[model samples]
Structure formats: structure tokens, C-alpha cells
Target: MISVLFAILTALSNGAASVLQRRAALAVPDTQTMRLSLIGHLLRQKVWLAGIGLVIVAAVCQAVALATGPISVVQPIFVIELPATLLLAGFVMRVRVPRGVWYGVAAVTVGLALGMASAAPGGGSTSVHGAVWVPALIVTGIFEAALITGAMSTRGNPRAALLGLAAACGYSLTAALMKDAMGRLDDGGVTALMTSWQLYATAAAGVGALFLLQNALQAGTLVAVQPMLTLGDALISILYGVTLFGEELRTGWWLLPELVALFLIALGCIELARSPLASGHAAPPRRSTRVT
Candidate 1:
């Protein structure tokens, strides 16, 4: 229950962070795309700094959730971030969220509850053999590379979706590394935690995730990216939980409800993506000063 609470809080924090960070990123000059200098510029923005602070909070909450619960259980909860982001973005942009959007949000919330209840994921081993890391990393790395390449090769919404998918992969990998690091901490002391390769790997994956997130935000509308980000992370996290952490979800009779829940969630995502809250409007043009 504690882990579940933490996971929900993490989703809220991450959703707010995404909105704030994207707002700041959109304000940056277009010429800064894909450059390390982009980070330097964003660092100077107070809004971006606030977003980073929220990101740190979200990370801490996610770590606690992962330490206390199964990865399959914790990661799926993050899908709420999509609805949360839309709400936050609407508030920030001073746009009223339409009634239809609320219906979509309701679908997402209910679908998530039903899906989690039906699946009842449980029993995971955090400490896997070192040999497991090689194949897992290699396959994930290849997939992420493909996503990044696809993102860079396109423009507009397609590019944003691709980058968002890459970011999702990076975030899922980071969560796995974080779970391993927490397990190391439990087994060993502070020294072991500091020395664990998983700790450093988590940090690296986090940085990569942030990089992809910013790029995705710059590429197009949040509508184009958010669904891919949320769904990709959940699906990839499930895969990681099963393969790397030895977690289990109910099968057979439970599968029917799970499939239904997934359909509802997908329907909600489509509706939310089409909502006015997600299709952000352009800012009004600034008036020019005339010297007579």
C-alpha cells in the first residue's frame, strides 16, 4: 500500500515536471535542438529548474516504490502521468479542459484500476546474475538506438513519438537498474551501494532519458508524444519485470479482464490525445512598438 501511494505520487510529480519542462523547452530558440548547449540554456531558466526539482522528487518516489513493490506493479501506475500532464498543461496554458477530456481521464483511471486488479502481479527477484545484464542491455540498447534514429530522421509528430518511445525505453531501463541498486543496498552497506555498477548505470540511463524527453518536447505537440511515452514505458517495464526481475502476473482466466482493461486504456489514450487540452494553441503575437 505504501509503495502504491508512492507510485501515484511519483506519477503526479513526473506529470507536472513534463509540463513545466516542455513549456520552458518550447520557449528556447529552435536552433538549439540536439545540442549539449540546449541543456546549458535550459539550466538558466527558472521554470526548467523547477521542473528539474520535480523530476528529482519523482525519481526518489519511484526508487522507494520499486524497492517496496514488484516492478510490474509499480510501473503500470505511471500511466496516470498522461492524464495528469494534460490537466497540468491545461491549467498552465489557461485552457479549460472539455467534458470529453474528463471522460477520457475517467476511462484511464478506471482501466488502470481494473487492469492492475486483474493481473495481480507479484513475486519478483531483484538480484539477477551478471550474465543477465549483457543480453538485456544489448537488446534494449539496439531498440533504443533504432528509436533515436527514427526520431532524428523524421519531423513533426512522428519525430516526437519516436523520441518519446526512446525516452520510455531509457526510463524503463533506469527503473530496472534502480531496482537492482536498491537490492544491492539491502544486501550490502553504503559502501556497496556506492560501488555498485547498477547505481551508475541508473544515473546514465536517467540522463539519457532526460535528453530524449527534452528533444521529444521540442519536436511536436505533447499529444503526439505522451501516449507513446506512457504506454511504451508500461509495456517495456512489464517485460523487464518478467525477464530480469522474475516477476509474475496472473495468466489464464485473468487474461480476459486484462485484455479488456488494455483496450479501455488505449481508447482513453486516443481520446485524450485528441482533446483540446493536448492540442496546445500558439501564443498570441506580440505587438510591435512604433516610434513616431
Candidate 2:
């Protein structure tokens, strides 16, 4: 219950930060590309700094959540982020959230609850065997490399979706690394944690994830990016939780409910992604675009 609360807090912070940070980033001039100097300019934006603060808060909440709960439960709760962002953006932009968006949010909420209940018997430890990290790291690295390479080959929305998935993978890895580092604290106090390489790896994975997210935002609109980011992270995190942390989900007959739950989530995410207000869209003037 504590972990769930913290995870929910993290999701809320993340949703708000996504809107504020991405909006602030969009304010930067088109000439700025991927230059490090862009950091200086972004830092000057009050909105970006505020977003960064929220990000830090989210990180802290996430760490606590991971420390206390199975990764399977904690990470999947982040699926609410998309709907939260949608509603928050709607309020911030002073636009009425469409009825369809509310329905989408309901669907996602119900699906997440169903999925969590279905996966209720999941079991995992706070840490994995050191030997497990080797294969896990190698597989994750190769997968992220493939995603970035594929992203580079694509353009527009496709590029955004690929990059978003890459970011999702990186974030999931960061969570795993953090949990492993937290386990170090349990074994040998702060000294063990400070000495652990998992600590450094967590930071590195987090930075990599943020970089990919920024690139994804730059590559395409929120419509193309949000669902991929939301769904990909939840799905990938489950894989990491199960494979690396030994979390187990019920199978056989239970797989049916899980599949249905996932399908509803995917549907909800896609629907929410198309919301004009959440997407920072100007609410398409279709009649005008049609040469009226």
C-alpha cells in the first residue's frame, strides 16, 4: 500500500513534468539541435526548472516505491500517467477535455486495476543474483541499441514511437538498477550502497532515458509519443520484473484476463493519445483545413 501510494505520486509528478518540460523544450529555437549549449538556454526557462524539480520529486518517490514493492506492481501503476497528463494538459491549456478522453481515462483505469488484480500473486525479491545482471544488461543494451538504430532510420511519428520505446526500456533498466542498489543498503548499510556499481548504472540509465525522451519529443508530436512511452514502459518493466527479479504472473487460464486487460489499456492509450488538448494541439480546424 505504501509502495502503491508512492508510485501514484510519482506518476502524478511525471505527468505534470512531462507537459511542463516538453512545453519548455519546444520553446527553444529550432536552431539549437542537440548541442550541449541548449542546456544553458533551457535552464533559463522557469517552466523547465520547475519541471526538473518535479522530476526530482518523482525520482525520489519512485525509488521508495521500488524499495518497498515488487517492480511488477510499482511500474504498471505508471500507466495512469498518460491520462493524468491528458487531464492536466487540458486544465493547463484551458480547454475542455473531450468526453471521449474521459471515457479513455476510465478504460485505462479499469484495465490497470484488472491487470493488477490478475497479476496479484506475483512474487519477486528486492534484488537478483549478480550473475543475472550480466545477461540482463547485455540483452537490454542490445535491445536499446537496436531501437536507437531503428529510430534513426525512421522519421516523424514512427521515429518518435521507436525513440519513446527506447526511453521506456532505459527507464525500466534504471528502476531495476535502483532496486538492486537499494538492496545493497540492506546488506551492508550506506557503505555498500555507495560502493555499488549499480548506483552509478542507475544514474547512467536515467540520463540515457531522459535523453531519448527529449529526442522523442523533438521527433514528433505527443500523439505519436505518449502511448508508446506509457504502454512501452509498463510492458517492458513487466518483462524486466519477471525475467530479472523473478516475479511470476499467473498463466494458463489467467492469461486470458491479462490479455483482455492489456488490450483495454492499449485501446485507452491510443484514444487518449489522439486528444487535441492533451497533445498540445490547436484543436484541428478541420473545416478550415478543408478549404472552407
The numbered model that scores best in lDDT is 1
The models' CA-based lDDT, in order, is 0.87, 0.87
Q: Write the per-residue lDDT of candidate 1 for residues 1-292, one digit (tens) a residue.
A: 8779999999999989988998899888989998999999999999999999999999899989998888899999988887898888878866677787788899899989999999998898866666899999999989998998888888999999999889999999999999888888677877877899999999999899989998998998877787788778888998999999999998999999998888778778878888866766534336699999
lDDT of 2 by residue, 44-148 (tens): 999999999999999899989998888888899999988998888777656678998998999899999999888774678888876999999899989999999
Ten consecutive residues with minimal summed lDDT in candidate 1? 277-286
TM-score of each: 0.81, 0.85
Q: How many backbone clashes does candidate 1 have?
A: 0
Query: How many clashes (backbone N, Cα, C below 3 Å) per candidate?
Result: 0, 0
**Residue runs of model 1 more than 4 Å from their true location after superposition:** 19-50, 91-94, 149-159, 217-221, 282-292
